[model samples]
Target chain A: EIVAAIETALGGGPLAGRRVLVTSGPTHEPIDPVRYIANRSSGAQGTAIAGALAGLGADVVFVTGPAEVPPPAGVQVVAVETAAQMAEAVRAALPVDAGVFAAAVADWRVASASDRKLKKTRDGIPALEFAENPDILKTVARMTEGRPGLVVGFAAETDDVVAHATAKRARKGCDWIVANDVSPATGIMGGSENAVVLITADGVEDWPRMSKAEVAQRLAARIASALGG
Target chain B: EIVAAIETALGGGPLAGRRVLVTSGPTHEPIDPVRYIANRSSGAQGTAIAGALAGLGADVVFVTGPAEVPPPAGVQVVAVETAAQMAEAVRAALPVDAGVFAAAVADWRVASASDRKLKKTRDGIPALEFAENPDILKTVARMTEGRPGLVVGFAAETDDVVAHATAKRARKGCDWIVANDVSPATGIMGGSENAVVLITADGVEDWPRMSKAEVAQRLAARIASALGG
Candidate 1:
């Protein structure tokens, strides 16, 4: 249903005509004009996924946060900072064949962010009211109309990733959940390699510890298969 | 007082015998193994400052957080993710002639960051308690013992840059405050160019719109002059 033409990378493959939306990086929730709340998501995996999707001949709309890496060439990029902006960007880029929600969207944002920079006090700390950020994947997954044919979400956990991700699949109402253990001991949070579990309606499948690029390629292949390409 | 023979870049000049410390980037205060709070600091200005300091023949100890840009070459880079770690790195790199606090340190960290990832709830959002982060600039500026001869702090403000910066200089007890407006209208925040107001004990000096590199060079020159280089 995406009438607007999206620029895709060179080389037509199995997914040549398909359009995909990919969210990458850590979403910053503004606390003030100069300060924000964010996470340690380097967006390496997300970036790799976007590239993989593009390589598979999909027109990739890369919606990213302030990621460490620059956007990969030959994709339509929409750069947003805060979670709300990211959600809005995601919605705007929707009505695609498939969607990947890989960004570590902050669960909460300051309910009332200060327009001015919050000043430091001698003794007292500022009381920040909190508001839950929109669940982008859930919103897209539950869409009654114009939803992407396949929707994916990610779960970064420290313990019991499968059990947690299994529950998350049901909770978020997403088609699949890519779960990974991000414990410091795993050296996966900011590291280059990742071991993930893919939970679907069928069951959970464990992926071996591999380079993020490999993971992306395998996941992209799976997407192609699921989409009957 | 830096007895350890630290490495210095080639071609000693105005800052040949001086040691300088610079802080940049945004600290990621962990909310969980995978979630954190951070600011929107690109670390461009701080990297430029460190490069400029090194260009002036100063032994630069660059303490940085999770930044978008990579650390500059020929500087002692101490990378950290949290505000506490940044403060510790700064302390360890101390006994310097000058210190530039450019890092956008998160004001608060989760009071008790959960060991495991908080799950997606079906009903309501999780409540996150926050605690004040260590005041890195204030701590370094107020140090009577082994205090850096010249301490400079940055104040990214949106309104009344000079007045707020002047007050911040007095309040934080720092020697000078480099204040800039970050209102979206200015296109300064996360942008390459900056227009700043340098507030000192003498008076406020307005710096023209220039690339962050130029600002760093000028500031480095001022530091060299103050150190009687």
Candidate 2:
């Protein structure tokens, strides 16, 4: 019956009944007009997730940074560049059913972004001051009101991946953490397939590597299950 | 002096005194002409990691699945297709200081592959017998001879990501597992960027999402630190 209900919903589900919020891509901390600190994140994952959620009978608000790929179809898309912007967008989209923080948010941003490009005068060395960005996952998890029923964070690591991810779930105060090694050799960052581990308070679940599309489909199914969709 | 000496060895340092073995990409199980069961991994992350390891001065042996991307410069590259082939290659390149299993290995293979393509059926799903493939991480981790000092596995999940990863690491007897949520919308499988959690018996470490390349650099540094390279 539950499955039947979900099928019915997907066939013509009411988005007015459910809302989801997601974040994706790499946040940039500008040092100058020509140079900025950023990682390689296309935001494809986040946008794809938003699309999947919408398909599964939810109203999705996708908050994203600049990405190489386009967002998925059929949803309310909110575009943002910096971590702060992404955070603001997320905060506004709350009181939703769920939240997935898939964005590659920079931990540190320039203390003060330069108004113009910094000139290099062949100095011995130059140092740029940095300040930590707001922890979006922690923020939402700790929200007093308008909080989503579910909050998930992604941990990109290199060593002791599982142990660290489990600890992160606690530290971030989120319900779940998805862990993966980003070692360049894994091609996990900008490539076409991934091997991932899901972490939660209960323990861990390791899935065999699969296509990103497969991951999205399964996750949508699981999220729907959680929402009683 | 340490850095200079290491750089001299490979025109680099850290990895100079280390031997690193890495496995990446997806295994293809051919079912028939132009038809094979395979994951959608491009081997970009894995190869980049090998490059990062090399950059850190480790002598890397990159055992890879068929990838469109070329191996990073300077590392010893061994290319293979099937999981069995990859296993053989890894075993042959053993006696390394550390090992990372980043490949999205196919869990099963066609029991008997057809030499030619089969005709389409009128009204039925095609059935194919399957056999479990050997787990490279488990095999290497349990090896009594020529085993690398550190062994890691990749766990991809959609639901219960961490719980399943923890169990897999324990079962595989690996030193660590990189857990990731490859849920579809996240685009974690391809197009660059990832959010991952590092898991181990000690606990979880949640890292902000980043490029697979950046993750590789950090991981290499960690390995070097651990080995005192």
Candidate 3:
């Protein structure tokens, strides 16, 4: 496939013989058809990642939520919207070499969905009940059968970004957690560029801000190098 | 002001006595009226940080490049485009309690710009020259007068993510470097969720993945918590 040629051109085909699965964007939690809870995620990071992985020669399966950008060519793409839908899609696409749960899936979903959009009542307000959604990262990380060799999760923090992220990695049972402060001023979410910290059991590593695409390229290379172990 | 109230409601009123400066988004390096060399960066992370800092009650000055989204409600907003323009904005805005260089400034720019878009040559090949751009984070971090109490730079990495990021923090002369693997698969760019690593002289600390908004909130809170030191 021409895709194979492109991958070889990028480098040594770092991800050669590896299978990678990635999640991207915000998973919607619907209160009603017209009203849903969603974060401001454009999915640029996710799609860029898919391209990055393919460029490294990985057989990548991208499970994406709704995104403004097109998915990268030459990868298996499964699209979904809600948190539950995303979880299912990821589950079906697994048995990969590695997994990165980068999606901002809502922590909670409406306890019940209204088939129709809820009308604005004459009363001042309306209360919608909710329940916790499945933690996809945790699920995959803890898989008993054919678990990916590496599982990474994202922990976005506004305060004590490192502290909370460290705890999260332990709680979620993932091998790594990438943390960042996404305060509105940082312009990370729903934005094109990002600044983040990578938290692993070993320690933390800081970075200078750069284009997300460049970041993807480098990460793919690193993952490929790690595959030799 | 209502903006101040929103800050309090957002759980960042601790910044009341502090002063903070933040830079967000990508700086456009213009080559012509219709075209420019610019990285893909939305102002989400930086803007979120500005909001978080403001919420903590800090007197915040937000220096931003071209961003699609509106700046958080209650902070001083300065909009610039080119990396040079961004540097100017930061110079005017600094001398704060803390400074966060969260913007994804282009590393290089066209050596010269054409007043109009250049037409394609008959041969269909054009040569464009480039030069290194200013290092804003290093400049501010190494300032002689009224230097910020805390200065942070972001490290966006893909390969040797942690090792490279740690080196960047030292090169930039910042107190801390927040590193993220932007490998296309990591999805830190243009995504709602992020994973980060924090690197200091002592060691690295990895954080968990969460919503970008939460990351901003936690980072701001930590900054405030470290106010006395």
TM-score of chain A of 3: 0.92
Off by more than 4 A, model 3: A1-229, B1-12
Name the regions of candidate 1 deviating beyond 4 angstroms: A1-12, A121-123, B1-12, B120-123
| Candidate closest to the true structure, highest DockQ | 1
User: What DockQ results do all the predictions give, each relative to the true complex?
Assistant: 0.59, 0.01, 0.01
User: Which regions of candidate 2 fall more than 4 Å away from where they truly are?
Assistant: A1-16, B1-229
Fill in the DockQ of model 3: 0.01
- In candidate 2, position A12 carries an lDDT of 52
Question: What is residue B144's positional error in candidate 3, in angstroms?
Answer: 2.1
Rank order (by TM-score, best first): 1, 3, 2
Which lDDT value does model 3 have at B164?
84
For B80-149, candidate 1 gives per-residue lDDT tens digits of 9899999899989989999999998888888999987776576666777878889899998999899999
lDDT of 3 by residue, A83-200 (tens): 9999899888878888888777766676896644343344522455657788899999888888888887887666677888898899889988877676657787657787878877
- Local accuracy of candidate 1 as per-residue lDDT tens digits, A1-229: 0221232323457788899999999987888877777776889999999988887788899999978777887689999988899999998997899999999888888899998878767666777788888889899999999989999999898888898889889987999999998889999977889999999999999999999989998999889889887
Give the C-alpha lDDT of model 3. 0.76
Give per-candidate clash totals: 1, 83, 90
Error of 1 at A40 (Å): 2.8
Q: Is candidate 1 or candidate 3 better by TM-score?
A: 1
